[model samples]
Target: MRNALLAISLIAVFAFFLYVAVNPGDFGGNTGDHLIFGEPKYSDMDDYFIHNGQNQTGANNIVTSIVFDYRGFDTLGEASVLFTAVLGVGVALRLLRRDKNDE
Candidate 1:
């Protein structure tokens, strides 16, 4: 069980790295704070797919499909991470609270 858990952890890490390497976070160009990310002239191909996606490809909720399809595994991992963080926060909050009598 321990080995299985460790292997999965490693695989998840590797998969994250592999996806990042393939999908350039910025297409070797400027993706700065000033950019709105969907400006027609400045946008990357990904932005085009996201903006005009639903109409172009006849798919509804383009953002949802993008989040779960092309980047499905990554998004899943990120969601798992957020869930773990929230769970930890809840557990910590519960532990930190004092009972009325204790206080």
Candidate 2:
């Protein structure tokens, strides 16, 4: 009975997510408006980045300028997360090896 209840709840949650994914509402716009899937919404920020990114960052490549200068903090956070995951896996492997040697 508990397993059946859990399965039903999971299915409900999945359905909710699927519905949301299919019908994502327009961002920063009026209610009841929907955005087409995979279509990018143009904003002032995008225009500014395209026009001024290279001048501001002195990077020849726009993508490099955005990643290294415009979004530095976000890039840092991603690198930190990747480092932490690698450290965690290394520690887990060491602990498992130590347990094997003890037996």
Candidate 3:
């Protein structure tokens, strides 16, 4: 009984994946909201960064300007979060190893 239930669940998950792969654009609900694969959704923000990023940030590289100047706080927050996660994992592993050695 357990094996049969597991097989059914696996088949259902596989069918969901296959459906998503076949109709990637059907997620938006509306007919006009379909997104083409591999094409970027261009917005006014993109244009603004491309045209004025250098002038505003004084950085010759557009990517650098956006990361450091336009989104500096966001980037800093992401780095902090990543660092905390790594530290947490290290502490957890060290404690586990110590406990194993004690046993």
Q: What is the lDDT of residue 57 in candidate 1?
A: 51
Q: What TM-score would every model get versus the actual structure?
A: 0.41, 0.64, 0.63
Rank by TM-score, highest first: 2, 3, 1
Question: Could you give candidate 2's per-residue lDDT for residues 38-81 as a string of tens digits?
Answer: 45667899889899988799999888998999889999999999
Q: Which whole-number lDDT from 0 to 100 does residue 7 have in model 2?
A: 100
Local lDDT at 54 for model 2: 81
Clashing pairs in 3: none
**Model 2: CA > 4 A from native:** 1-37
Model 1 misplaced regions, further than 4 Å: 1-58, 98-103
Cα lDDT of model 3 by residue, 3-81, tens digit? 7998999999999999999987644344454464435566899899999998899999999999999999999999999
Worst 10 residues of 1 by lDDT: 33-42
Q: Using TM-score as the measure, which candidate wins?
A: 2
Lowest summed lDDT over 10 consecutive residues: which window, candidate 2? Answer: 30-39
